[model samples]
Target: MNDWPPVRVLEAAPRWLRKVKAIILREIGSRYTGDALGYLWAYLVPLAWVLAVYVIFLLLGRRIPIDTDIGSFICSGVVPYVCSRYAVNAILRSRTAYRHILSFPTVSPNLVGGAVFALEMVNSLLIFGFLLLLNYSVFGFFEMHDPVLALWGYFLAVTSGGAFGYLMASLSTIVPALSRATPIFLRPLFYISGVFYTANELPPTLRDLFVWNPLFHGIEILRNGLFIGYESLFAMAWVPITFILVCVATGYIVQRRRLSGAPVEGDASWAI
Candidate 1:
């Protein structure tokens, strides 16, 4: 009569969850260093991009693409895309940089990746709030039509980024050069993903083609959610959702094939 809990159950081994929590805490402390510089960096990256794009468009004389504040409109699109790309790059690096810890039994790719995602999300949320306040303070564009949809879109962008990062990391474990090219490959998303323009405003022919971009759907979703009277005619929520699922599955398959001799990384598969 052994009164032991099953090993597969997470409740049986708290250490799995503990390791992920510890990694997340350790990341926040080490990265931030208890200083304003780290905080400034987090906010500035997205802000700077927004300002640059806004100014360029300002000179063009039609800064307000749709019926929203120029600043808020730009922030709505740029912030999510910027954060998503950052997460993708950061998570990709985490796997290689933290290879030592990942080798430990308690630590797995998914756990480390999850910890990194948690860290990036913390920063992303702070960035979003800071920009939100800035828009309200400067441009008075605080009106939100569908807050729920907006939030869901923002989460989708970041999660899709994490999914891509996971896939890249898993691929990097095999083909290192491919991971290095991720940024260059993703650069076009900024121009085409509706960061500076919405797909809804395009002509029917162009809109149909533009709507095919999953990133565009995330941007349109966030934009529609943030602004008032801006009903987006394009964007299918299921596009990005499906894209994320595919990426995650592909990443898992890649990881599994490469590390077939042992359990897939992220002990306590429930750790994710």
Candidate 2:
């Protein structure tokens, strides 16, 4: 009979979790290293950004028209969008950034990009928490429609982002051009994805256009789940789930091919 009490395997679980935690801590530390203002600056920069946007929206006479509060409204969407951007960027460069360490058998290619994303998610949450605190303390906004849905939305976004990140990281090997063009492609998405406004306010034509945008759907559903207690303007879980499946399958296929020693070079970059 096989022995069930394997001390090494049990010990390895804690060790691996610790290693992952260490990676997160190291990434956070590196962000603040040599900066005079340090980590406070990290928290402050996003705060300033939100304040600027909030003031601008106020001047614009409530662009999205949130009757409850604007700061909390913006805070909900902005933080997640920022996290999405960071995750995409981090995953795209994970290959080159961790190329050295990836040569080792014990280290995983996904770990570098995934860890960066994980850490960034934590950072994003901290920023969101600050915004929540500010809204409650200063703006007198204390509304949480559906805590369960809100939590679910966060999990779904993180999962979708992580899966997409892994896929992009693997594809970068074959499509280096994507690495260059992805940022440019995603720029318009920030404003158009309904981050600063409600999708219900959009014109019929514009709403139709946004309905096709996957990120738009994700953000909208996420916001609805949290703000309206899962009463989304476009409540579709399939979109993000589909994107996750497609990306993961494609990334895994690409990883397998590359690991099998294919000549994966040249114009294959465009196909990705």
**Residue-wise C-alpha lDDT for candidate 1, range 1-272, written one tens digit per residue:** 24555645646458776787888877766666657897687788899999998888878876567876788888888998999998898889887678777656567788788889988977897898899899898877676788898888788887878888998988877788988899987898888788888876677886777676777888888877887768787768898899889988998887766644555554443212
- Tell me, what's the RMSD of every candidate? 3.6, 4.9
RMSD of 2: 4.9
The TM-score values for the models, in the order shown, are 0.89, 0.81
> Residue 113 of candidate 1: its Cα lDDT?
84
Off by over 4 Å in 1: 1-13, 259-272
- Clashes in model 1: which pairs? 108-266
Q: Pick the candidate with the highest lDDT.
A: 1
Output the lDDT of residue 153, model 2: 62
Instruction: Please report how far candidate 2 places residue 123 from its true position, in Å.
Output: 2.3
